[model samples]
Every structure is written in C-alpha cells, then in structure tokens.
Target: MATRNIYYKSKTGILHWLGLAIAIVLLDQISKIWISHILHYGQAIRITSFFNLILVYNEGAAFSFLASQSGWQRYFFTAISILAVVVIVYLLKKHAHQRLFCLSLALILGGAIGNLIDRSLYGHVIDFLDVHAMGWHWPTFNIADCGITIGAVLFIIDELKRVRKS
Candidate 1:
C-alpha cells in the first residue's frame, strides 16, 4: 500500500498561510526601515535591563560567520536564502493542509524572503533587537530571525509529534 501523508487534512487555504508570510515580511521590513531611519549604524538604545534597540548589519550567516570575507559572503548568503525560499515554498504548496507544519514553513518562508530583500537592496541584513546579560551581549538579531527561529522550533515539535504518532 502507498504510504499516506501523516498530517491530518484541513480546510485552511494555502493562501492564508501565504498571507501570514506576507504580513511577517511587511512587519519585518517596516520595522527594519524604521530602525534604520531612527538609529545611526552601530547605534543602540537600552529598552530594558536586558534588552536593547540597535541598528547593525550582518554580511554573513548567524553569529557573523564569514562576515570578515571580502564581500563575497553577501551574494553567497543571498543565494542560500533564495534556495531556502524555493524549498520552503515547495513544501508549503505541497503540505498546505497540514496546519501546524504549514504554519512553520510560512514563518521560515517569510524570514527567508525578508532577509533576501535586505540582501538584494543593501547587500546585508539589518539587525536591531539586542539581548544582553551581565556584561555579555548576544548577537543582535531582527524580526526575521525571530520568525525563523520560532518556526524551526515549531517544525521540530511538529515532526516529533508526527513520528510519535506513526
């Protein structure tokens, strides 16, 4: 017998998930643009004991990997984001009825597209949110990063549930 798709069928339209992705991209872009306008590069404003608003750019993947390279990293990351977007879109289209899985994919898709837009326009990704601790600062990130991180966690959870059910 052919193996069946493990996810439950749903009535949710793929368009709805795509809408969510578009909303995320809009919010991320708007926030980044606003931050860029309000804060000079490398500027930071303390928002709380452990939080900050800042404006910075990343030319590489997470944690500044390859950031020291001579500008080649920008196009490299852009290509990677494009590939990820294509894969995510394909999965989203194929699994539109899987609510949770599709939701996770939509989040990742939005994030990839958001950073892709940044790479295309600025050759870097805009990062603002800064979380810190006692004399230690985590790498600054942005809304797109949040979406991608949350989506990854949710994707893992959904997959674990699916595996357990099988």
Candidate 2:
C-alpha cells in the first residue's frame, strides 16, 4: 500500500496557502496605515531603549538601494516586484504539497504584493519599525520587509533540508 497526499490533489490546499498570503498582505497594509496615521513623515517614536517606530518612505529596493536615483527606479522596482509575485504564485501552485516550500513562497508573495501596492499608489513603500544598538541604527523597515526576509530564510532552510533528504 502507498500513502497519498490529499493536499496535492485538491485546489483547497492551494487556497489555504493563498489565504496565508492574503493575511500577510492585510496585516502589512494595516500596520502601515496605522503607522502613517500616528506618525508624521520622518518622525520617530521611541518604543524601547533600543528600538523605535519611525516613518520612512523607501523608493528603491532593499536598504534603499537606488533610492537616491531619479524617478525611473520606482517603475523599475514595481515591475520587478510584480514579476516576482507572478513567479511566486506559480511556484506555490506547483509545489503546494511541499509544506515549507509553499509557505515560503506564500510569505514572499504576500510581501511582494504588499510593497507593490504601496509603490503603485504612493511611489514608495512606507517603513516604520526601527532598531538600534550601540549607537548604530539599522535601516527602518516594515511588516512586508519582515515577511520577505523571514520567507527568504525559510526558503534557504527548506532547500537545505531537501538537499539533505536527496
């Protein structure tokens, strides 16, 4: 007798992962909205001895790469994020049975879409969460950035586990 995975045989399983993605997007957007409503642009609110909540608008990729460039980078990054969402969706559908892989893709998909919405509407992504230690401050980031970073790390771990299994 052989064991069968029902999740891979039905559409509902895929929807379950998609739902996770949607939830991430909603949470990301809500957090951004709350931050915007409470904080003025470039304003920082101390949360802890080593952390603060601040408002920042990022017009470029991670760590504000190309943020100082002309306006063209906005369109470029938006397009790239849109393309990444498409790819992540496709991967999710194809490998939904692979729990960790699908989870990683779903998180990335949600994060990508969350930032994409901001870029399309405001030409920049809103960032609020900030961390500092020893007089050094890390770049400000938001929920979407957290999702993407965590997802990327999970993806690497999943790949390593897969390689080990093989």
Best by TM-score: 2
Per-residue lDDT of candidate 2, residues 1-33 (tens digit): 988866447554779888998999999999999
User: Residue 161: error of model 1 in Å?
Assistant: 0.5
lDDT of 1 by residue, 1-166 (tens): 8888877556787788899899889999999999999999999999999999999999888887998899988988988899998888888878888988999999988988998999899988999999999999899999988889889999999999999999
Model 2, residue 7: distance off in Å is 10
The Cα error of candidate 2 at residue 67, in Å, is 0.2
List of clashing residue pairs for candidate 2: none
How many residue pairs clash in each candidate at the backbone level?
0, 0
TM-score, every prediction? 0.91, 0.93
Candidate 1's error at 32, in angstroms?
0.5
* Candidate 1 lDDT (Cα, 0 to 1): 0.90
